[model samples]
Target: MSLRAARDDDMAWLRRHYHQRRAAEFAPLGWPAAALDAFLDQQFALQHQHYTRYYADAQFLIVERDAAPIGRLYLLRRAPEHLLVDIGLDANQRGQGLGAALIAAAQDDAAASGRGLRLHVEHGNDAARRLYQRLGFEHEENLPTHAAMRWRAREPVATD
Candidate 1:
């Protein structure tokens, strides 16, 4: 399997993934229905717009197996860190360690770029939060229905 930046072509797949997986977190957060509808459209449109400045800023990754896309990860850069805005593996691809592999890939990417791994998981998503915790991330803040988490590289060793 390989993980690489997603192409504009992958937008269709990404939207299908999100549309099918809309979080139950929003209802608890009281997110306005119309507001969420617009937000989702704008978020997906950014990838389709090839001429936008954000084209290069946002990172969309596609996980491929034997040249076929099996999963997607969407990231947003916010100055000090890379935020994991979305991640999804095909249902058949789940429970086979692909999710962990993706995070490991992100960890290496973050280490190389000198930025910490960051994400916002719905507060009610115990499954994902537990997975993040197991991957060495720590809770940083709560956003009503969600929580921000971070994984930082350990400090350098002391010289002899």
Candidate 2:
């Protein structure tokens, strides 16, 4: 249960992870294997380009457990706030509190710096939305495809 910097060799695993993430949405379309592969490839490429261009300085990390890659966490540290660009786990790794642990770590980092943590989750992603809410992330804005959410560190209480 640790994270390491992503490397060139991780492209293949990343691609597979991307495909897995979107496969369920497209699965019902009943497209041919070739067509589905092509579509996913193109979509993955586009997403890669978008993240690369916009989050050039972001930390692209590979989440691992027992030396095996199981997830990814992309983060961008900026003034007054930090962005949780993306976080995904292998399908098999879901629902075991791993995501919560990862986000908790990010929260700690932001709190230590006195910065708020922010992220966006797709409207259709109810599970993610619930998790964020449970972690104290409040809805800040609505976008066409996603909802912006933010979490601020709780201030310390003064005692006599």
Give the alpha carbon lDDT tens digit for every residue of 1-160 in model 2.
9999999999999999999999889989999988998899899899988999999999999999999999999999987899999999999999999999999999999999989999999999999999999999999999999999999999988999
User: Candidate 1's residue-wise lDDT over 20-103, tens digit each?
Assistant: 456443456677877876666675566446423544576777889999888887766555677776788887787788898888
lDDT of 1: 0.75
Best-performing candidate as measured by TM-score: 2
**Candidate 1 structure, TM-score to reference:** 0.73
TM-score of 2: 0.97
The candidate scoring highest on lDDT is 2
The per-candidate count of clashes, in order, stands at 1, 0
C-alpha TM-score for every candidate: 0.73, 0.97
The superposed Cα distance between candidate 1 and the true structure at residue 80, in angstroms, equals 2.7
Each prediction's Cα lDDT score?
0.75, 0.95
